[model samples]
Target chain A: MIETRGLTKTYRGGRPAVDGLDLAVPRGSVFGFLGPNGSGKTTTIRMLMGLIEPTAGTARVLGQPMPGAVRQVLPRVGALIEGPALYGFLSGRDNLRRFDAADPAADPRTRSERVGRALDRVGLAAAAGKKARAYSLGMKQRLGLAAALLQPRELLVLDEPTNGLDPQGMREIRALVRELAADGTTVFLSSHLLDEIEQVCTHAAVMARGRLVTQGPVAGLTAAVLGPGGHGRLAVTTPDPADAVRVLKEHGLTGLRADGDRVTGELPEAPPDGPAPPDPAELNAALVRAGVRVRAFGTQRPSLEDAFVRLTGEGFDVAG
Target chain B: MLRADLLRSEIATTFRRWRTLVLLAVLAGVPVLVGVAVRIQTGRHAGGGGGPAFLAGIAGNGLFLVFTALAVTLPVFLPMAVGVVAGDALAGEAHTGTLRYLLVAPAGRTRLLCAKLVTVVAFCLAGTLVVALSALATGALLFPLGKVTLLSGTSISFGEGLLRALAIAGVVALSLLGVAALGLFVSTLTDSGVAAMATTVGLVLTAQILDGIPQLQAIQPYLFPHYWLSFADLLRDPVYLDGILRNLGLQALYAAVFGSAAWARFTTRDITA
Candidate 1:
């Protein structure tokens, strides 16, 4: 678990990279940190990892103040920040061995075994002997992942684990994240890819301009955007647009718009504890009774992206 | 145990590199090349030709080659080599993006800096030994070994002479500790390994240059390399401790001053790379 109280960092002569923001990451949840480029996600992660000192405020990672307790806390927290920071001249196995040797608790006698196991887990066993500089981007990323998994960590904090990966590599990383979480390790990952987070995260937080826009369980976030009906849009295709609009208005729909052969109307807001929206069957029956030829009626439930856009405003880096 | 493991890793990663091997080989090769050149020259001319102080003394005792090699490499080659290794210790890792990973090892910045310093000092010892050993071997093949005469008109046994050579090599390595510490401090200031390396070597060159100018004599005593060659006094009969001690004290001062500076800079750094 990690918590922060107004954890802020301001570089010299510049704006704060991370403003006075509060954050809470509970244990055993695959928490997704969502944001755009330069949204201060990496800065916040660095502060928690004790890579950088916060200019103001403090962070408690694993229940201890950061940096002061980093030596004890970090070993139990596996992380792949930015990308795989691999030594180009060293073979993948050598890099892992070097990092493993740094951990005082790691048994040197079993270092080889641990290194090999880590490589195997990341699917880099075949290329384990090659110099890291010779590896492809995806291979290097996986090697970074392997370094993070040199031991069984209590938590995994991965920063954009699939930044430059192809579709297949992204899928592999996503699967690996799910597998780790399934094994009971809390995963706190920061990513610009909304779909990736939606696919794997149980809880998510959105950051914009160094502020937390919103954060909660994934289902709850999506449900928040579409009212209680859990659907974002409803559209009716009809030749008799006049009758369709009048009938839909009579049904107490608001924000109605009409075009040639089509009429769209916004349903009433369903309070969190309120009853569900009226069934489409009743709407169809009402339209039929009003002498309107309903060609088609379509409804779309809001996606994680749509909810995210509403939370962080437009132009979030959905693919980055 | 943690320190040893970290030290083992530092040494392993350092010595395994092709660049490090190349630097060592070049260091070890210098004595051989110098020995051969002196041998061919002496064979053609009847010991009338003069070279470096140790090369000139080789006709009397080949063991002086160790002294000569240490002396010859002290000014430029050795410090340049030490500068490269020390400068690259931290900055190279930063350049390659491995510094962050090393820190994530929770290798506390202080511990990591100390580990890097130990590795560089180890290189200084190893580099000096290679030159001394190669020179000793080449000198034995080229000249005779016997009771060595001291600089102050006294003689000592060959065994004592070997012991003195080892001591001299050690002193010579200690002479570069200042440079190593200084290089590490510069490394902490920059993420570019090349920039750090160039800056360190440039500082050494500038110090040596300043030490030469008569106008800079007032400041020369404070420079790290000012008394580098003072190890020559160890060959004196009474074992001139004044200059040697001063040289060592100056090195210690540089190490203490620059070592703390490096630690401060490194520990507070943001590690943006």
Candidate 2:
């Protein structure tokens, strides 16, 4: 678990990388951090990891103040920041062996085995013997992931883990994240890829220019902005548009638009007794009562991208 | 343990380069070359004659010039080598984006710096030994082994001469430590290896120039490179050990201060790379 109360970090002569912001990451859940480029996602992660002291306020990882308490929490945390930091001269096996020193309980053979398994998981098993300098960019990214996965710490913080990956690699990484979370590891990852987080994260936090826009369970997020009746994108093919319009008007809905065969309308604030917006049951019953044939009446949920745009505005990296 | 891993990784990475191999070869091979050159020069001076007179003549000249060259070169070149190696210890990691991985480990910044400093110190001592051994072999082959004369015009026994040579080597190592510490300090400020190397060499050249100018004598002692070769005084009959000790002590102080400064700066650095 991690928490920050009004944490702020300002670089000299530059905009504050992380502004006054509060954050909370619950234990045992995959918490995705979403933000745009230069949006202080990495800075907040760094502060949480205790790599840099906050310019103001306080942050705690696992109930310990950052940086000062880093040593205590480090044994229970694994992280991959920016890019993989490795000695290019050493082979991938050696690189793992080096970081394996952090885990004292694991012996050399056990460590190697763990490292080996991690490399295999990341699809870098074949390149384990090669010097890191010889690896390709995707290979380096995989190696970084392998290093992060070498041990199951209580918390895993990864920044942009899928930045340079191809579709296949991204799929592999997403599956790995799900697997880790399923095994009960709390993953706190920051990324600019909204779909990746939407596909895998159970919870997420949105940041903009170092400020936390909103954060909560993904389901909560969907309900809050996506609106009731499942963020209506209904593809209703009604036989009587005039009758449907009259019925919706009677319900106090407005902004109805018709294009060819489809009619779209924005639901007004839900009535006190109503079950959220665009209730499929209510609409179907109303149409049936009106003697109108309803071909399609499925609920429409906004894509995570649409939600992100709604939350952070256009031209921002909201997947962070 | 993480520190050891970092140190091992650093030593391994540094020694793997062709440049390191070439440097080691040069350290080993240069003495023999100097020995052959000394022998040929002695032969020319004697016009095909060889004896104690020729040997003593060559020995006297080689001890001063060749040994002096080694002393000056150790501080000048060896420290630069140490600079290149130590300077890259942290910055290169930052440059290649591997510093974050290292920092995120359980090891603290102090521990990381300790590992890097220990490795740099080892390299500095090893490099000094390389030069000393090379020069000693050359001195033995090109000239006779016997009592040696100091720059101050006093003579000392062969045993004493060898001891002095080792002492000088030790002093050379100590002197380079100062530069290495300074280099490491500079490394914390920048991520570019080339910039680090250039800055280190540039500082050394400036210090040497300051040391040479007569007007800067008052402030020269404060500069790290000023008394670099004062180890030569160890060979004096009366043995002016005071200056050598002072130089070594000054170098130690600089190492401590600069090294601590490097640690102070590094622990607080925002490693975005």
Candidate 3:
């Protein structure tokens, strides 16, 4: 539901914060925008939300040009940019009511009912009467989520939605996102947590240093990390690591390393001129034939974490 | 319909703050203090003509207390109160990060700005009424009520004097719109609410000081506070409209100029906060 073309924002006397970004978020997909801190994810989101105009380029949300069409488009889009910003003096319920009042399209007659539902959805209904200043960081984060869910939206753009939450709170937010997505609402979730993306996202985009490294379905990203053979490293635990290594090398497993009782090697790609790489079961039979006491044999599939690190050339906070 | 709701929300939020209440309390206190002080001074001396312009008349007619209180507070306390509210309107929202949510609510930038200005203007009226009403009540309790004397030395009924008092309170409130608009303009220039408030109040004080200087008389007519005290001319026999109209016109000019400036800056500027 969101698209950008050559979206670039260069602050005065500084490098472009978001340089030549072209993002396409589909209508019914949970799109994960993964990047490290200061990687322009928030900048891109801000531009998309029309909070800040792009120095050069254009952004469209729900098929209408941004900033220019903000009034027409934004009412249908819910956003929690950066974090939950609230009036500390106002109660959580009042905060929701105020934000609800801002939307011209929101029905005033049902505002209280909708605000209550949003608060309950975020598990903040009990604390709705309390001033927001007294809320914990996790509660504030949830209240921010509550504001975004105040109405049934066509698109929900959340930046770091799970930040400052306990493990339980994080799980709850993830579940909420899943529930929202299941209802056919497109969710644009941005985070540095690789695990969050892996757990919840259907489609994913990897960004590094203000540029898109790669993007596609989560399965495609993980599968693409492996070569054309779609094979990963072959790991074997044996009494005679030397014998197992010899057997694996004979089977054409490259980058063999033997340490203690374990021998790990890269399973080579299918050879065009020769033959296919031996399967893990075939390699195990070969190790057994070599008289190596095999304790364990498995192929380690690459994870999204490994894919993100490789794609971005930077480590991500893999912990949810 | 939505604009009305937004405006109601803005007005409710602005008046509900303890800071706003305290500012009103302080403004309301000024009239009581002045009325009590005048009562004491006249009681001790047994006559008038010792205090400020309107204070000396409070002993004969309690209604003069409203006039005295507005005169006393108009130059500083009233505008300072307006400055605080107006200056914090947008910047406070930005500092609290609520501005983004409000905007994203699709509260159109122009619509939100209009709501904020309306709320600030409401404060101007409310603040002035608080001082006037407080002074009227305190005046009734402290001094004798009788036929009212105009500044031109003509006698008018007490009801007419009361009507004139309400008119003066209104004029005093209108006198503050220039400062209100200026404060709102300053608010759009910063994210720090405190900084915006301080700058607005400082600008008002500086303009007052400049208006006071004889050397600056050439440009004094252009200053926002130049015609502030023209409300006193309302007490004249025919109720002089020259200075009152000029003050209102000057305030309208400032409101138009700075209000548009605020709109320009707010609509075009990036809301990073």
Candidate 4:
């Protein structure tokens, strides 16, 4: 478990990077930190990992006071912050061994075997022997993950773990994060990609301009209430576009757009408690009343991307 | 334990670098060149008539000169390299992003710094040993083995000269430790290896400059490079211990103070990488 109470961090000669934030990540859950660039995501993770001190407030990891109890807390936590740093001349195995020196009493053979398994887990067993400099960006990121997994820890903190990854690499990383969470390790990750977070994270927190807007399970976030039709993609096909607009406006549903024979618009994440839709059962009744014939009507569920954009006000592309 | 691991890791990494090999090869060959040059020069000077004692006397006087030159020059050239190698031990990793992995493991900052310091001191010792071994071989071949004359005009045996050379080498190694500590301290403040190396070298050169100024003579003993040649006093009749011991004490003081300061900085440092 990780908890921060009113935590704040202000960079010297600069504005507060993380401002008066309160956060709690339950154990054994994949918690995603969502924010755009310069949104204080990295700063929060750094403070949680004891890389930097908080300007005010207190943070605890696994029930220990941050940084002050770092020596004890760190052994139980594993993290990869910022970009991966590696020794170009040393192979992946050698890199692990160097840090493994923290526990010198461990059996070298067992350590090597654990390293091999981690390499396999990250799907880079074939490239483990090659110098890190020879590996691609994706391979290096996986190697960084492997290093984090060399020894088991209760909490794993990863910042933008999937950045710069291709489709296959992204999948592998997503799978690894899932597997880690499945093994009962608390995974706290930060990413701007809502799709990635939606795929793996069970809970989430959004940050905007250094202050946390809100946080909770991804499913529970109440999308802004939309009137009658709902706030999601609705496909309406009509022979007459002019008639559909008139009908929709009369029903009090605004923000409508038309392309060719179809008039389309979104509802809200949550349907407003106003009036019900003209009732698909009454589609014929409504069409006849408005002097138009409705060919078809279908509703598309709002994606996690739309939910994120609505919550954070940051325009995002679904395909990305 | 981290110190031992760091030492082993540093040894493996530093010894394998092309630069280190080139340095070792060059350093090892110095005595051989000196021997050949002495043999040729003295053979011509003697008109092929002098006995081995004359040659031995000539070599003894020249051997200290060789030792002195190696001591003074290697401290400047080689320890700066040691400083560069050791200074980057942590800062280099931080700059490149490897430090995050290490830190997340939550290894004690004290242990890691200790490890880096020991590795650098090892390099310093190895560098001085190279000079000692090279000079010993050159002294054996270029002149007679027995050394009966001292700089104070007294006399001792060839075995005594060899022993003194070894002692002198130890002193040189201790002096270099001080240089290594200075580098490591600077290492804690930076993330750029090039910047750390440049800063360490600049500091060393500055100390050397201060040591050389006549007006700074009173403060010279405090400078790291000042007593680098004090090992020569060991070759005197009574074996002058004043300057050599004082140099060792000062080096010890530097190593302790700088090493502790590095630990303090490292523990409080915010490792962004």
Off by over 4 Å in 1: A225-230, A235-250, A255-265, A271-276, A284-297, A317-320
Per-residue alpha-carbon lDDT of model 1 for B39-71, expressed as tens digits? Answer: 887788757645667677886789988998888
Model 1: CAPRI class: medium
Best by TM-score: 3
Least accurate 10 contiguous residues by lDDT in model 4 chain A: A221-230
Residue B13, candidate 2: Cα error in Å is 3.9
Candidate 4 clashes: the total is: 7
On lDDT, the leading prediction is 3
Residue-level lDDT of model 2, residues A180-236, one tens digit each, is 999999999888888888899989998877788889998788668656544455445
Error of 1 at A30 (Å): 1.1
Name the candidate, 3 or 4, with the larger lDDT value: 3
CAPRI grade of model 4: medium
What DockQ number belongs to candidate 1? 0.73
Please list the C-alpha lDDT of all candidates, in the order they appear.
0.88, 0.76, 0.91, 0.75
Model 3 per-residue lDDT tens digits across residues A143-233? 9999999889889999999999999999999999999999999999998888899999999998887888788899888878654534577
DockQ values, each candidate: 0.73, 0.45, 0.83, 0.51
Please state the error at residue B183 of candidate 4 in Å: 1.0
- For residues B160-231, write the lDDT of model 4, one tens digit per residue: 766777777777788787878888888889888778888888888898888788998898878887777777
Model 2 spans > 4 angstroms off: A102-109, A226-230, A237-255, A260-262, A266-297, A317-320, B1-9, B17-19, B47-69, B137-161
